[model samples]
Each structure stands twice: as structure tokens, then as C-alpha cells.
Target: MTSEFAVELRDVVKRFVTPEGNEIAAVDHVTMQIKNGEFFSMLGSSGCGKTTSLRMIAGFEWTTEGEVYIEGNPMGHTPPFQRKVNTVFQSYALFQHMTVFQNIAFGLEMEGAKEDEIKQRVGRALEMVQLTGMERRKPKQLSGGQQQRVAVARALVKTPDVLLLDEPLGALDLKLRKEMQLELKALQQQLGITFIYVTHDQEEALTMSDRIAVMSNGRVQQIGTPVEIYERPSNKFVADFIGESNFLDGQIKSLSKDEAQVFIPALNTELRGIPISQGLVKGEDVVVSIRPEKIRITEKNAKNDNFFKAKVTNTVYIGADTHVYTESQGVKIKVLEQNHISRLDTSSFYTVGQEVGLVLMPENTLVLKKV
Candidate 1:
């Protein structure tokens, strides 16, 4: 996560002619830098051009405008095989007839490495991915997770300068996917290699990436570490896209460097928020976003700021935590609390039709200009 960028895109854009003969913009003038040895990820919904942007980096797709660079070298016109990178696709794309060893060895073989060198490299890679003894088995004989590991082994066997993974865990089941996410993070740290991962799963992105670029409408909306992105989203799109949020449409009543007061006309309350950027003025439409976990439900109104009262509408318990839905000033709000030893006061447990007070943690609330 240093200042030295491993990959840089300068106003890169990609477009394709749809069947209706209209040109569609997929990657729209995106400019970003992936730091050296950083686990950078591009995350977005389907059709947002995250995959298209990765393809351009992989040399599978060409950019209609701008330039793409890897380690300060221009990558335009370079073939995928000739680039200093390797890719692990969602399907693994392993040769069905090839044994694990063979699949891992293929890359080095194609690179013209000597026989002994290929054997040693492939064996070491198999062990690195924890698939040493499974090398003799074919892809079809292994479990989905095992085959996925083999695919990782094949990619690492090449020892490319950078690894591009396009939804590599998309096909795995939930439990397997979660396990692989941790494995991938550990492997990345152990190898100290640059990984450009592409995915739409916000949880996966937040879990594994050193930094994430949230994309929408083929444009990068925000780029930051998980904490920064979650707590200080740049705009409404990013605030809504990353996690569960309770948005209150309001008008900017006052502004300052650290905080602002938003007037919620419907609630007739001045909601305090931490402003993300400047230029907001009085009378300008704005929106304040507060995460569900930031809201606290209480039986009595405590002496504190950022407080409101709501009526309990629903309560959902998901083992370790509880989600309480309530309405305040005709605006719905959600609060999430862990069922831990300290916070459990079940005597005051909220029930439908019961009134409860809520306090939005001002430090956790984000202020965004209306879109």
C-alpha cells in the first residue's frame, strides 16, 4: 500500500456496439492506481464494466481510449501470454483430462522452462496451495474447493508479476467460499505478490482487499480501504452500494469542515453528520446516511445528542445478533445489536407497537450531497 503504483489507468474507457447498433460505454473514463504489492480489487454489480476493465488489463479486451500501464510500462497491444501477469477465472478453466500436476506444469512447459525446473516449480506450487498429494488426481475427481486450489496452483506456478482473479470464488458454496477468502488473503500476504481481484460481492471485497474501488455505471465511485469506504462514503451511490444504510433526505442548513447540520423537513429534526466533502450550502438538497449498527435502541431517553424516538415494527434474531426495525418520524430505521453478555437487557426487549428511542452515533453518520 505504498505510493509506488503497480498498475495505473489514465482516463481509460471501453465501448462496444450493442445489437441495436448503439455504442455502449462499459468502462467510462476511469483513472486509478493500484499500489505495488497491494491486493487491489474492483467491485461492482454485473454489467458495470468491472469485468471489462479487468479484461483490458488482461489484454483480452482493448480500451477505446486512454492508456493502461503495469509497473510504469505501457501495456497496450501486449498479448495476454506476453504480459507479466496471470489470471484465475471463475470457472478455474482447468483442462478436464489433465491431472493436477499436469495442469500446474502446463504454464511452465509453455514458457519453455527445462524439464527439472518445471517439475520443481510445479511441485512447490502444489505444496504452496496445499494440494501436494492430490497432484495425481484429475480435476473431475476433486471437490470444488480442491479444484479451485489446483487452479490457484496453476496460476502461481507461472510466478507472474501480478495475478488477475475474476470472481475466482464465484462457483463455490458459501462455506467453501468463506474458507477460500481467508486462504486467499493468507496466500497473498505469504507470497507478497500483486493481486488484481474483480468481484461484485461487497463482503468479499471488504474481507480480502487491501483497497477497493467501488464502481457504478461503469465509473469508479469511490476508492479506499474497507473502513474508510464504509465510514466515509463519498456520495449517495457509494453509501447505498457498500452496506445497509438508513438514508434520510434533507436540506443542508449549515456546514463546517468536520460536521454539518441537516434539516430533515419531515422529522423536523436537525440531524448532525460528518461531512465528506465541501461545497454544500444552505438550502441545497442533501442526504444523511447512517449505518444500521450505528443506531442504538433504548427504553428510556438518555441524556445525549443525536437522539430520536421510534416505534418498533419488527425484530429479527439471527443467532449472534438481532435486527430491530422501527419507525421514527414516519421514516424507517434499523438497529443491529450483538447478543453479547454486556448489552443484553431482555427485560426492555422491543415489541411491535412499542415505542423506543434511538440515537444515531454522530461520528458514524455520513453526509452526502443529494444526487
Candidate 2:
């Protein structure tokens, strides 16, 4: 096992047999690597095999094919306890009878560390997770956040080379979940340990991971940095999954080096966009993706070349922001605006049934072949 990479999976495949004897592939021919001390994530919707992949790496499930390596050593048949990895589960599975201190110290004690050494390690791990004074409290006595911290502290106290977290914050409320996300990121940096995090929340994955692998239907869709995944999605699935986008199906009207023009017949307009693929020709079917917030809403008939007129169908006020939904050329477009800014001088406040124009910025509009 090398120390450079904390985890590696090569063409890992896992299958299970149903009650009727049918084979169901939970993980289908996947290969990935998580570097040492990096925050990595596997993100996808429900039943996408994200959690199944994580379990294979954590030694909770045996792979039907391929190999899993930890620190350059094959974990082909290694038992969960033998591998130098720890896991923090979504349930915050702390022992009921053990106090926070004992729970954190349990792993070290099982490893047969000296009394003094276990005390020092457990104390430091507790302090690192900011649960220093609550050592005497049992799991039932601690708040949800505090109990979750105990789970983290228990895993970290052992000083494993890799940590696997399967939606550790899934049980927490929104505010607490957000708080733990920041805390977990900071803690990973402080300890310099590889963290393999799994979550279905796109925003959480974007906010936390250094690099993310987006998976669907037991296969990886795309693996890239957050910006790359969100700004230049490889396919329609990823483009629609990462964030709110306006998807327009049109035919390629023209193509340049990196840009193209798409014609939407319903709108009777040609829209300019960024093309990420080659082999596209004139009249070929294409899909254009543009973020909702990247569009500028105008009250007057703007002279912009890419502007399209629409009627405001509804308005949604979300405390700090407002979402304006409009129908233009048979397509629904959404515009999000922060409520902090004062009334703008140009565009008037949108109202239901009012006519408005939506403009898509050139750089923000992405054009790709339909998936």
C-alpha cells in the first residue's frame, strides 16, 4: 500500500441476486481514485449506486468483480477491521451505554494502545471536533449535532489513513447540516486525511468536494471539479442534475470553433451558445442549457440580439430572493434575483400576466448535443 492515494477502485463491479434469481448490478464497471488528504465525493440521485460504491470501498460489501486498493495495497479480500479506514454512518451510530469519551476512546482501546497514549489521542480528537467539555455526556444526552460530532470523533480518534462518510449529515436539520458541512471540511484540512463523502444533495457536493464523481443508473456520468460539472456539463443528465437550468431543444443552425447557433422553431429565433463537442453539423438536433440566474429580465422590448419576449406567469418570493417564472416561445424560463438590492432603474418589478423580455448572456449559455 502506497501512502499517496488513500483509496482506489479499478473496474469495480457488484451484483446481487433477487428473490426470483435475477441478477441486479448495483455497481457497474466503475473505476475511480481518491487522493490522500483530499475531500472527494460521489454524488447522484436515489438508487444511483452511489452508496453501494462507498460501501464497497469501506469493506462493507464484497465486489463481484475488479479490485479495490487502499494506499496502493489490494483490498481484494481484506476484512473491514484490517483495512486502515474508518467510517462515519448517517445514523450517528454511537453506543448508548458509552459516554462520549469512551466512545471516542473505544477504537484506540481495541487496538491495545497504552492507557496514557489512548487518553492523549482521545483528548486531542475530542478537542479537534469541539466536543471537549461534553466527554462525560452519553449519546442520549448530547444534542443531534453534538452526537454527530461524537461519531466523527470516534472515527478520527483512530487516526486512520482514510475516512468514509455516507451522508453523515443526512439526519441533521437544514441549519445543522449546513454547519456540519463547514466543520467537516475544516476538520479534513486540519487532519490531512482522505475523506470519501457520499451525498445526493447537489449543492452540498458542490460546496464541499474538491472533485466530484456524478453517478446515475449504476454508472458514472461525469467526474470533474465543481465548476466544470456545473458550467460545462458533459451531457443533458448532468446539466439538468447539477442546478436549475433552462433547457431548449433546437437544431444547429451554424457552428464555429467553440460557439454555435441553435434554432428553436417555436420561438422562431436563433440562439448563440458554447458547444463542448465536435462532429456537430448544421440542422443537427442540439440542446441548449442556460442557468436561470444568468438571464437578465427586462420590461421593455430590449434591442439585445439574444433577447426573447415572455409573459410573467408567476412570481415566487423566497425571503432573500425572488424567482420569476415566465413563458416565452412555448418554453418556461426562470429568473432569480436577490431581494437585497433596491429597485432597479431599468427593468420594472415583474407582475403576473405582464409582458417581459429575457436575455441570455453569451458566455453563460451552454450548447451541447442532446443526450
Candidate 3:
């Protein structure tokens, strides 16, 4: 029977020995399930094991311990070509000498497919990537984006049950990369095939992934949709890694089922927030986290709960949003305000040293367990 999951890693661990004779686990007992036809991403910085995990799934690297399963069958020492998966690498790995059609048809030709079948599959793959007419072009003759499409086309020509991408768009320019992100997402949805993407760019993962597994120190820190990962990070690492977070050291003064009152030592006040981490107890040290955009800055002194008087330390206008840095009770905070009103003068902008009222909404405030 076909499994609901396209891939599964059960307590998988990949260990490596450094030149210094020290053993390290590149993937440390990490477990994840990529649903069938899901656009799943493994996201992290360098040396965080995201790439190593992908290599294991692609059969390029075997797990040092545990098992990697594809469609519920254990893939123990399985060769890359024998697996029902295809990998598109960052370098595109295209044949510089071969034409696009021949490059894409390389795999089918190796499989001993009839000449007619090879042509048909290659044509369909190129058409899928919107590069039908460019089949005569060589990899060196195409633009970066076009070359990337050719790589994708080559991978798609095999019609693998699952597609593995390791930073496939990392070689493109910023503008082109952003454009391809949307295109890749759309293609995945249209094809309805499982896409397992590995990337270090947080924004890229957020832009294209249906679900993301945030990895750190060879472990999966959190797995959730972009909304859940950004809005409610599971821990301090996830909160800080996924996006910008202003953290304050605090101790839990009171706890409820969903809410908690944390006493910030820096501010000398209690702030109410949702406890995102489990197993919280009273008097436990916690980190209070809030996104810059979630903070509200008011020019008027609004006397309300969780309101604090702050002085603007710096202001940066970055086109769509203005980042205002403030200091309150020795704690620095950043607030992101959108430029909703068009203005030609500096009068509308907040100047450094200007006093402002900062409000922290309980719903947006997150209390995370200090690691």
C-alpha cells in the first residue's frame, strides 16, 4: 500500500568524523514526515544539518543510525538511482556541452527508454517549466534563471515520485531568486508532487514551503506552517532564528492555562503574554519575545496596561516600513511602523530622543522557556 507520507525519517542520525578524530552527529536522531504532495522545507543556517538530512533522504548519504523511509519502505543502503526520487542541486549540475533537450533526456536515455518516449517526456518536462522552445540552447548560452529552469526540467523528466532540491535557486540574483520562488511554488502545486527543499534562507523557506522544519545543532527545533513558525515559535532558538525577536529576561510570576505574568528584571514590571513553551512553572526564568512589527508606538501618552514610556534611540526608513529603535528602563526595543501615509517632510517621522508610548499586546507577546 502507498503511504500517506512521501518520506519519513525515524530517529535518523548521521555522524561524521572530523580530522581531529572527534565524532559529531550531523543529523541527531531527527524525525520528520513529509506528506504526499506537500512542499516541505528543511531550513537552517550552515552546519545546522539541513543539507545533511536532505542528502540522507536522497540516498547520497546513509544514516549512521536509525532509518530513512520513502513511501513507508525503509531505505537502507539504497543507491541514489534506485530510489524513487530525483535531486536538483544548487549548481544546477547541467551538462555545459549538451543541448537542453539532450541534457534533460540523459536520464531517460540511460533508462533504455525508446527514442520516441524520451522525446515525449523531455518535451513535456520542458513545456512544464515553460522552456519548450529553448531545448536547442546549451546551459552556457542561457541566463541564470533559464539554466535553473533547465535543471528543474531535467529533474522533472524522470517523473520521480518525490523531488529533492538543495538550495536550487541560491545561484540566482536577488530579484530573480524572488521571482523563481513563486514560480517553484506554483509549479509544485500544479504538478501535485512531493517537493523536499533544503535552504538556509529564512524568507525563501517562508515564501515557498507548505511546512518547514527548522533545524539547529543537528536537531529539528520546530516544524509548522510559516504562520505558526513566525507567530508562535516553540522555543528561544526558534523565536530568534525564524525572525527578529526582542528578548527580555524575565521570571514567571503567575501562570494560567494559556497566559502567564512574567516579571521583567530590566523593566521592573510584569508583562502578560501567552506561554508558548510547555512545562512552565512559577518562578522559572523565561524569555519574553515580541516582534518589532507587533509593537505599537503612540505619540500620545496612553495610560494602559503593558504601556511603557520610551525614548527613540534611532530611526531607519526602509521604504515600506520605518524601524524605530527605542529604550525603556534600560531595555532596548525595536518597533516597525508601516508608511501608510505618503509624506515629503521629516515632520511625520519620529526623531531620535523623542518620547513615545509603547504598547505590548498580550496576544502578540510570547513567553518562551530560557534554554
RMSD, each candidate, Å? 2.2, 2.3, 1.3
lDDT of candidate model 2 versus the reference: 0.87
* Residue range 181-233, candidate 2, lDDT tens digits: 99999999988889999999998999999999999988899899999999888
Off by over 4 Å in 3: 273-276
TM-score: the better of candidates 1 and 2: 1
- Those runs of model 2 whose alpha carbons end farther than 4 Å from true positions after fitting are 1-4, 278-281, 343-348
Segments in model 1 whose C-alpha atoms lie over 4 Å from true places: 1-3, 273-276, 299-303, 341-348
How does candidate 3 score on lDDT?
0.92
> What are the lDDT scores of the predictions, listed in order?
0.87, 0.87, 0.92
lDDT tens digits, residue span 1-371, model 1 = 33377788889999999999999899999999988788999999999889998899889988899998887888888988888788898899999989998999898999999999988998899888888798789999999899899989899888877889999999999999999999999999999889999998999999999999999989999999999899889998988899989999888777777678878887778777655467777778888889998888766566556777788899887778789998877898889887774345665456788887888777787778788
As for lDDT, the candidate ahead, 2 or 3, is 3
Q: Kindly state the number of residue pairs that clash in model 2.
A: 2
Clashing pairs in 2: 1-73, 2-71
lDDT of 3 at 170: 92
Please report the candidate that would top TM-score against the real structure: 3
